[model samples]
Target: MPPLSFSEGFAIAAGLVQLFVAVVFLRFRHGRPEWGLGWWAVTFAAAGVMNTGAPVLLAAMHSPFGTSLNVLTMVLGISTMGALVAGSRLYTGHPRPGPWWSFALTWLAYLSLMMTRQLWPGYESLIANGVTGLIFAYLGCLSLGAMRRESGAGHGIAAAMLCLYIPMVAGAYAMGLDQVELRYWSAVPFALAGLGVMSAMMGRMRAHLRDLNESLEQRVADRTHELRDIISSLESFNSMVSHDLRGPLGGMAGLSGVALSALDAGDTERARRLFQAVQAQSSNLSNLVADLMALARVSNVALLKQPVALSELVQESVQHLELSHGEGHAQPVQVAPLPVVACDKALLRQVLVNLLGNALKFSRKAARPQVRVWAEVREGGVQVAVQDNGVGFDATRQRDLFTPFKRLHEERDFEGTGLGLALVRRIVERHGGRVGAESQTGQGATFWFWLPATETPI
Candidate 1:
């Protein structure tokens, strides 16, 4: 092809720049939901088309058609100002210029020029160009205000608007004095301004993506740690259960065999004693097995939530304690009315049963043994308290309370597997509740738990 004309070369360069900006705009369109930035992209792209096409048309046409094209360019210029105002308003969170006023003012200005063009064709282009330049200058001031206020996307757009307007301003000044070539170089800065805005938007998007990836990685790490803790707990539980049950079960079997042999040898008294010892050992073994199973079930069972009356649970626990200890031997226990809560009824009852049982067992030697159950309403939940005037444990020994097989008293003094409170804690926590105790040396102990309240059905 032959060497391209000035207008043709400028149009080709502007078109290429427009294509690049259009691609950038499209790429980030879905990623950023900010309306100001979106409008800026659309305005810049449309301006690019007008800038590229106008010059080519001016070069190809003459007289009336050329004049009409110039008028169309002036109209596009007014639209560019309106877009800038609206975009700035969005970025700054300020009230937008009324649409009706903007439309009326812009068209009124253009119509005055149209009439001027008909009356004085010679000066029409100059007047239209000056009016367009003034509109751009006014929009630039608004953009600068947005930048000063530190609006989102303001700095980048302000810089781009400044870059684009500076050349147009310079071209307008030169053109007033009949210098034409200066206006030709305006395309270069216009393209640079468009590129700058797109680059800023891309940078913001990349930062957002990086933050999202970091958050996802952190969540994965936390989940992995949780799974590891759960596995470790399960292994420890299995080891303890195996070691505890083996010796007791073996002894019961051996003792039963011995009792049978004694009876066969015709030693009646010795056989009777042996059989009694076997029965005691068998009962002990049975208790241990039952406790172990209860603990295991409590740990493994999933929480089933429903509205449970706390008073009823406490009453049931007290009745069971009374039955087990018997009226003659059992100490006086006091319980208060409680509010309803949302929790797993079975698990919560198990917790209360263990706590009350522990209190009764330890207080058997106390002169005035007492156990009290009550609840206090709290913000968003309720706190249930189980207090006992028993052989209270030391506060220093608090950590051992919820560990399996860690007994506070001797096995002879208290017949227990030392898993009751541990089971209580596990069950309470599974129901999204918390359990804790308050005690001092020789003083009474208080075990309390908090459960979230349930909303009443409408």
Candidate 2:
């Protein structure tokens, strides 16, 4: 109730400021959550509470509450020191000896002082103050040591801690000699030091986060380059295979056809069998050439992006497949209305053609062979699907299904070059899309791909 002294007023103001700062730190600290930061938060809050309660304790100098508050202040100060040490250790990724010993020592020293308070209260206060001061000094030294080791966030925090301790040491020295007037204003330096330490800690944390992001970006770039190299190699290999094998296959087919034609004019039954064998071999050779060409095209073709109507592409592919299959009385391919997508029209047409052709080829022996093409809009892209009631492959072997020359069925049952889906996958990926299939053994398969939608003109 009485008029407060200058020291009491200053202490109260400083305590409130410390409390405000601590609260502000807590509010923003959630943005960067780490073990080191948690320790720092505990330290700041404890220190703030101690400082804020100091004035009331000083005002009621002779009361039991004042005595209890003073003890609590010392306890909190010791806890804060330990927290700073632990926090520094955590930030630097260093392991520390057990913290229980330090806690035990602090409490033991505090209790000893309390036991001797009746006989030498002033001496006990000085000893307790000195002990706390030493703890802070030790923490600061440790921080300085960390700073010298490297240029990092930890180093910056260490330097800040060291700076904060300078004034604290000065205040402690002044307080030990009963110079209450000089030590009374020590809260200013203490607050400044706390602010410096916190700022450094925040700066270091931000730097570390930036470094982590940079490292991740570098790893991603490296992986991208690796993938590009693999794709380039695959393209070159396919081109070589297609170019080298085509000449020999063509020669063999031509020679066989000539030989069969010559034998037909001389002998009847023998000529017929020879001619059939030549036809089968020629068909196989043609399939091999087609597959090799498909593989080469998928690997090496450069895509030219343009607006393409999905329905038109599907119809074109269906027509091409029909011509290749010899205009049979097959069930007609049905294509639904689809949206326009941004892609290389030629490559996309090829992709659809191969998918549809595959569907038709595999479904040829079915009682009701049907192939359907459709498109659907999705988030960030559009999906095109070609579904067929074909002799589907095993889902478990789907990975191998896309590899060149990997055939599930025997050559006699299903005639294919086995590069169709592989080519489809390459073309879709080249257009910045993904291709996938869903099927079970005996059930039909759905081959689908997603392409980025054309952006609307402003």
TM-scores vs. true structure, each candidate: 0.63, 0.48
Clashing pairs in 2: none
RMSD of each: 7.7, 15.0
| Candidate number achieving the greatest lDDT relative to the actual structure | 1
Tens digits of per-residue lDDT for model 2, 1-458: 67776775676676676666567556756665543666666766776665566655566666868678667666776677666666656554554553445445556665776777789655665565565556566666666775665454544554554455446656656655354543455565455545655555666667778999999999999999999998896797677567546754675677577667767677666666656776776777777777677666666767788888787777787777768776662355778778888899888888888888788888777788888888777768888898888889899988876676677888679766667777888888888889888998778888899988745321
Q: Which stretches of candidate 1 lie over 4 Å from their true place?
A: 1-159, 162-198, 205-236, 268-300, 319-331, 377-381, 431-433, 452-458
Error of 2 at 122 (Å): 4.7
Local distance difference test scores for all models: 0.70, 0.69
What's the lDDT for candidate 1? 0.70
**Tens-digit per-residue lDDT, 307-409, candidate 1:** 8887777778777777877864444668777787888888788888888888777776778888888888666778888888777888888888898877887
